[model samples]
Target: MKIKSAVFVKGVVGPDQILNDGKHKIAFIGRSNVGKSSVINSLLGKKGLVKSSSTPGKTKEVNFFLVNDKIYFVDLPGYGFAKISMQAREKLRNLILWYLTSPEIEHSRIVLIIDAKVGPTKLDQEMIDVLKDFGHDFVVIANKSDKLKRNSRINQLKIIREQTGKEVILYSSKTTEGKNDVFSKIFE
Candidate 1:
């Protein structure tokens, strides 16, 4: 699964706008500012390929990126942005739910990102439960691993695995840590 080319395809605000061709899709879902875009850019071995923002809620649409023209990496909108209006928040919630449940999307795998230092939150738990109920296989990527103490990082992975019953790959976009393992699991 060598990545020959990674290109941004488009952004969708609704289910009808999503590109669906039965191609294998890998979706990235997480709270706002969880380093989802950064991970994508880093994976492609390029900076700024997928826009990343310092502010939360900057990404409010589902972004589809075509990878090697063989599969798709969908960047689902981030959740838990307190500053957004209730209406907008609800819309985002619906969009995410639609992406996950839509038969057309049919993602082959999902990557749930979480801030390693902060650990998992209530919203994260809810997302995990939703994936479980949907019967979608997913892997958690604990981002910002470079910000955590070594011992604490290891313990956090343990805690996350125990809580979700899924293995979590520790990662840091800054250091490119865990990048190989993450891609391997997806293409494996």
Candidate 2:
């Protein structure tokens, strides 16, 4: 699917603020600094379309972006950062959990991202477990594949599949690798 247009629709703080009215949506979820924004920009074929930050936990709110008016790429806030305050982290966690539980999101597919370099963490596994229990259709996408050796990348995918019981598409935002594959899955 061609990205005719992609725009940041809103930054939501709670479930009530999300504009979830039957539009197809796929969310990006991962730990902070996992290159979520970079992938979003790459998918849109625009530089800096979604704010990409070097610092972790920069995306504190749920960002919804409309793509081709056919689907919404929901950028949920990053989690599992160690430097943030406990209360603030709790709020972020609650916001994401609420959105995951929202009825409106029940119909949408989820694209759970894992940084290929770091592999999956405890938080990532927890999120996968939640998604599995929620009984939602989802796919794993291993981002930052450009940083790994080809063999290591393949091994990482195998490890992730063993841990989460889900297949993952390898991708790199820097080289536009796996861009078409991801979009095909999203539009399929």
Candidate 3:
């Protein structure tokens, strides 16, 4: 689907604030500093459309961006920001868990973002395990692929697919690599 317009809809910290107007919701989630915001901005064809930060944990609340007037691209809080206090981290963790497991979240497809160079961290694997335990399938995006050497890029992608047992897209938000594949999946 061609996106003529995309805009920020709302930012929700809990289930009560999640949009319930029946639009399809696609959410991006990953470790802190995993380029989740960059992917969202690139997919929408807008620079800085999603507030991204060089700081590891810039996105704290769940951000909802409306795409094509039919789907909501949800930007969730990044996990594994170790610089923060334990209390803050626990709060963010609870918020993420609540958002993921809540029935109030509707018509949602989860997109788990990974740093291509770093591969899947332990936290990433835990997230995958959680989703599997819950019987939810996710599309894994190996972001920051341009940072990897050409020879290692394919290997990383292979590893991600093998580990997740799901479709993996090698992506570079900077180069817009894998943008079409991601958008097609979102529209699907």
Please list the Cα RMSD from the true structure of every candidate, rounded to 1 decimal place. 1.4, 1.5, 1.2
User: How accurate locally, in lDDT, is each candidate?
Assistant: 0.85, 0.82, 0.86
lDDT of 1 by residue, 1-188 (tens): 57898888888876554456777888899998999988888877879888899988877788888989878888877898989899998889889888887766667889999898888899999998899898888888989899988779778888888877788899999998999899888877
lDDT of 3 at 7: 95
Ranking by lDDT: 3, 1, 2
Off by over 4 Å in 2: 104-107
Residue range 1-188, candidate 3, lDDT tens digits:
78889999788886554557777888888998898888999988899889999988899888988888878888888899999999999998888887777766674688999898898899999999888877777888999988999899778988888887878888999998988898777556
Location of the lowest summed lDDT over 10 successive residues in candidate 1: 13-22
Worst 10 residues of 3 by lDDT: 14-23
Report the lDDT tens digits of candidate 2 across residue range 126-151: 88877777877677888999999877
Clash count, one per candidate: 0, 0, 0
Question: Which 10 successive residues of model 2 have the least lDDT summed?
Answer: 14-23
Candidate 1 wrongly placed segments (more than 4 Å): none
